[model samples]
Target: MPFIVTDACIQCKYTDCVSVCPMDCFVEGPNFVVIDPEGCIDCSVCVPQCPVDAIVNAAEVSPQQAEFVELNARLARAPGWRPLTQAKAPMDGHEQWAGVAGKRAHLRLTW
Candidate 1:
């Protein structure tokens, strides 16, 4: 199974995970990120890179966050999602976007 981006990643979109993804499986969404199960190699590189611990393998994901696995897969196949580079570096620093827990700012508008 592929790595999943949990709700913790909403609005934050830390992007550190995006840089380390070996298969370019991470795709940017309006307010969050999604993993392409079809392309992910399960390298687990993105897991540690996420500052909020939003990236988790399907099997290891908490039950509450489990829906993200399918959400990532579905968004990955959706039209307009762009493929990120796999050879980039881990995102540095703290979470930039605040109040993500209260509102899904990324989902409010189409990107």
Candidate 2:
């Protein structure tokens, strides 16, 4: 299963995980990051590097955050979302709300 980035990564899109990803499956989101299921090799290399503990294997994602697996895959295919390896400094600041509930509001999927 592919890994997914969770709400904890919002506004703190640390690129450390991006730097460690061997398959370049990670993709830059507006405020966080996502993994391309089609590209990820399940190497688990990017998980430990996340400063906010946002990365998780698709099947292991917490029930509250399980939607992220689909979100990540969908965003990965969306037009204009750039692959992580192709970006020079992909992680950029975006509006983030504290204590946002639900998967959609908490995770910054768009700029």
**Pairs in clash, predicted candidate 1:** 16-91, 31-106
The best candidate by lDDT is: 2
lDDT of each: 0.71, 0.74
Q: Give a tens-digit lDDT track for model 1, residues 1-111.
A: 777887777766677777777677778766667888898888898889877777888989877776778788888877777776653333232245442453333452247
Off by more than 4 A, model 1: 86-109
TM-score, one value per model: 0.78, 0.80
lDDT of each residue in 1-111, candidate 2, tens digit only? 878888777666667788777788888867767889998888988888875678899989888888788888898887777888743442444224323434356555456
Cα displacement (angstroms), candidate 2, residue 41, comes to 0.9
Instruction: Name the runs in model 2 displaced over 4 angstroms.
Output: 86-103, 106-109
